[model samples]
Target: MPYCPPDCSCNLDGTVDCGGVDLKEFPRNLSESILHLSLQNNALEVIPMEELSRLQNLETFNLQNNRLTSKGLPDDAFCSLENLLYLYLANNKLTVAPKYLPKTLVSADVAANYLTKIYPLTFGQKPNLRSIYLHNNKLTDAGLPDHMFNGSDGVGILIMSSNFLKYVPKNLPKELFRLHLKDNKLEKIPKGAFDHLSKLRELYLHNNYITNDGIDNETFWKLSSLEYLDLSSNNLTQIPRGLPRNIVLLHLEKNAIKSIPGSWLTQIKNLEYLLLHNNKIKAKAIHPLAFKGLKKLHTFHLYNNMLERIPSGLPRRVKTLMLLHNQITEISRNDFAYSYFLIELNLSYNKLTSPKIHPEAFRKMRLLESLDFSGNNLNVVPSGLPKNLHVLRLKENEINSIPDGSLSGMTKLKELFLSNNKLKLNSIYPGAWKQLTNLQLLDLSGNQLSYVPTDLPESLEYIYLQNNQISVISENAFESTPNIKGIFLRDNRLTTSRVKEIAFEKLKFLQVLDMGAYSESATESKKDGGTSGDNLENDSEQATQNDK
Candidate 1:
């Protein structure tokens, strides 16, 4: 049996855990055969080199979330652990990386520290070292040498985000597969900075001050294996040239890009996700054939732009297209003629009106499952909505009525939000939602309703009628919605005597009846010879517990 410390737990498999014991110092008398030791989440400030060297067979050491500083760790602190494979020293006060690391180490995490510099040989010649995480540190370009990882030929992943580097580090390992330099002060990328990194697949350079002139034309042309590239939140006025041909996901949102010429994206055949929202892109500035060759593209986001109409030549196989918060006033019939595979469409917060939207605008979208047209100028729901839509949002509009047979084809609708409109009791057609057998949630709050609308779907589970003019709940108000679980009638004019007891007696599954602000309002209505004040208070309390 291995000896276990008084404040730690020891196992037969050479593992010791001493985490979160408020330990002020390192434990003593650890087994020499220990393979893993965890001292995280403690107050340990110093590591006894001689005592730690006794565990020659240790392979993993974790000192994360401790108070270890540079003075507590000597240059040769971990030199004797020849078999150490992983080391974690995150969340410390070290200003510099420790020197003379073991050659057998495979991974090192010194992130979330005060590290401002790293010696050239701090990592030594560890041939097996693969990953180095130094994020959330105070590292600067002057503290880093040109040949940072020259000895570690197998280093594949290096993360140095949130640093003060003014430019891309030079002489990185050619075998690097992923490099993260985001959230830095980088201003430019030299011509041959990444020419040797052919195996690089993911590069994150977002949240920097890089401009269009700061990048060379041939900077990223040689990265043939690159797949994911993020250049968002930059100062580029146009799309960069010479991107990798096989790139998959491209993020250029929150930039100053104004236009995309036809040749900018004609070479990227394997692109899947293209995010260009929050830019200054206009519809006419984009070439007609800008997205013609992207056959595998699925998601395209162009919201928060200056587009006045749908861009032509969208990806044929694109499934999600987000064009909200634009200046588009009309939707022509041929706008989406080739985008038949779209599953989700969001054109909300635009200048669209009822007559400007062609009646056959959405006729080709048979596979669309979600549609949002809220925050527009439409006075009524847009017709020609696909039958397979599962969610529909038309709130914050001027809609006042639901014409008969308008929504009779949406039998698969599950959630319908028509709140914040001008709807009234007599404006809605009777049995408008009778064909919606799969409906589950209906939102009609912030309207001009005088009474509960009859002919609600039987499959409804939740209803929102708050902030309306509702004053009565007839006995048959909820007769068709026996499966209802929650009814929100707060901020309405409902009184105790007007809300029949039988209206809530049949709702056995009702769990929430929000009638807040009703007591104060009902008291005023009762003073006008409505009902007895004592009876109104008693019935209101009983309605809240009907489910019990």
Candidate 2:
């Protein structure tokens, strides 16, 4: 009995759920073993094809969103669904591309629509057509068709991103494996445009105004199973020289790459994740054996760029080396003397100074673990850093001092950022941070401190002596830490009688005691000394008993 079709729902196996039921047509009598026919979100301008040619086993035909145009579709209007296998006309107002379809169709989603020209055997010799979503629409490049992708079609996922293609769309189909031409107005890629694609593997030409004179130094040299290549932003001023040497993720961030010609990492020796940050790279235009054969290069992003130094033969199996900012002023004992697999080293800002570093500059980083050397023009703290350091960002530099065994071989130090810098309070020498035993977050904020610089590390949990010149706190100060938890002392020079009543009672995991404006003049001097307020009522009852 399944002949439903009118604002439909007849599902006893015959399947005919007319989606968004306001269907403005094409829903008569319906059931001829109609194998799924959902006229999605309807106002179907046309495509009745004689009420879908009496549905002879129509294998899934969903007219998505709909306002169907292209003069309401007539030529071969799906040649009567001859066992059609999935054809979703996405969005709709189709300006073409809805012809005969059925070469045993296996997925053809005419995405968005108003498709500006694409009529040459519309997906020729469809070898079981494998996924084709013509993204967005207004396709250009003369509306596409230079053999429209041959090799007898077995199209393996081809999403023509955005559109208005300026080049690179000629006879693509080498059974393409994920080729999304992003944005689009592709300013050129015509060098045998991937002749014989070799099962191309993920190639998204980012942004697109591709330069280097429209690319062709053997254009990716026949993509030998290329692996993930996103030419970021575009207008590249180089670095696109026969890429695919089994490329493993190579995204040229931003672009306009100034120089790095060591045969581009000896022709991508299995390169592993190399994103050239920002770009316009400099440091004498890079070539000191340009990263001597990457050897599985691990995360190397040259932040910002115009590098003035530190590009001295990098890749000692680099493990995250992002040169932040640039103009790096010296660290010279052979720069990073054959890196030794460095583990995170970001020379923040740059122009680093303390006698231009060389005291065995980081004596071959014994697996460094996070070091930023913030802002730079450093006053100290750079003998040979890497004691397996765990995050040591010398903030805004000009570091006034902290010398005696400066952070003595960091014993796995955990987060220590000498803030703003130009430090004081005897510039910290007494047992400096007693070898940080895993110190947890300590930023002597905005420096020039007057106190609180004692041998902190009892695995302290978050301490940023905000602003500085801290008035006083000597009741055994933080009584040699009790896992102090967040004590910022905001905008320092604290008052409440120079803070003493068991100054934060051994910080029982004290939570956020930021007294920035010193508790508003100690609660207005507690209404001008109410209970004979000596020592500002014992520093406001020891900061309300160490914040309960």
Highest lDDT among the candidates is held by which one?
A: 1
Instruction: List model 2 lDDT by residue over 370-483, tens digit each.
Output: 888788888877766777888888888888887778678688978888788888968667877757878888787777888887777788787777666677777887777788
Least lDDT summed over 10 consecutive residues: which range in candidate 2? 539-548
Poorly placed runs, candidate 1 (over 4 Å): 519-548
Clashing pairs in 1: none
What would the per-residue lDDT of candidate 1 be over residues 216-323, giving only the tens digit for each residue? 778899998999999999888888999999899999999999999998997999999999999999999989889887898999999999999998888889999999
Provide the TM-score for each candidate, comma-separated: 0.94, 0.34
Candidate of highest TM-score? 1
lDDT value for candidate 1?
0.87
Cα RMSD (Å) between model 1 and the true structure? 3.9
RMSD of each: 3.9, 16.7
